[model samples]
Target: MWGRVRKSWSTVRDAFRTERDTGRQARSHNLFEAAAAYVSACAEDDQERIEEAAGWVSPEALSFGVNELACRAVIALARERDESPRAVARDLLGLPAA
Candidate 1:
């Protein structure tokens, strides 16, 4: 009797797990893709794309992804321009050099 109960519980758990996985697979884009879309949208100044990207993920996750992208971009720009990341960022923003 105990063995039967344990087997039934395992079957139920596996069924729920499969359902959750299927739902995840149905999502149009994952967090990383959303982040990339957000960065591209920002670079292009496309409000529509930005809004669409934001809707793809939780706000906190989106924010983290965007922050990571910005950090990488600043580092790349600084390397390309042979300047500090702060300087590169300021230059890009048309700010007076610090």
Candidate 2:
């Protein structure tokens, strides 16, 4: 399901963000995290907004976008599901989806 993709991307994005901005040393990896974030966010949002923004990012371009979007998507989904964001992320990430 979309949840897996969203979860994986969110994890990657968060990792990258922590490395890049949370006083770590993984700057190079941050770009990938940002890209994954973008994919997840774009997929979870309202269709109208996605459509409007779609034109701005080609599939190729999205590959290079920031993973922050994925972080955003998982957050949104967690809110919609009314459950623990970490639990949902773990489920989607294939960490025992209980």
Candidate 3:
């Protein structure tokens, strides 16, 4: 799973480099937009969309955005399930409760 994410990040970085060399303007997507699209594309196993979304922001920015998304998701799920954020995250990963 991590390998796939790293490979995608590398691909995005290379694409961004090439675009920068060509003096092309970056896409209008902000960090949140890029994160949402990237995650949705990954969930759907859509490589093209993943690449496109990944190109919208720097890898670091995308990483931060994804982390933010994850935190928000966990909080929302915890609230809905009446559980702590840690419990919700562990449950999502199939870990036994503490």
Which is better, 1 or 2, measured by TM-score? 1
Error of 3 at 95 (Å): 1.3
Best by lDDT: 3
Alpha-carbon deviation at 47 in model 1, angstroms: 3.6
Pairs in clash, predicted candidate 1: none
What lDDT tens digits, residue by residue, belong to model 3 across residues 1-98? 99999999998765433332236764366788889999999999999999988887788888888999999999999999999999999999999998
Report lDDT per candidate: 0.77, 0.58, 0.85
Candidate closer to the true structure by lDDT (higher is better), 2 or 3: 3
TM-score of each: 0.65, 0.35, 0.73
User: In candidate 1, where is summed lDDT lowest over 10 consecutive residues?
Assistant: 14-23
Model 1 lDDT vs. the true structure? 0.77
Error of 2 at 15 (Å): 20
Task: Put down candidate 2 lDDT per residue, 18-89, tens digits, no spaces.
Answer: 332446743443444445544555668656555433334444444445445557767899999997888778
Off by over 4 Å in 3: 1-27
Q: Count the backbone clashes (under 3 Å) in each candidate.
A: 0, 9, 0
Expressed as tens digits, the lDDT of each residue in 22-85 for candidate 1 is 5456445555677899989988999999988887776766777778888898999899989999
Query: Over 4 Å off in model 1, which ranges?
Result: 1-25
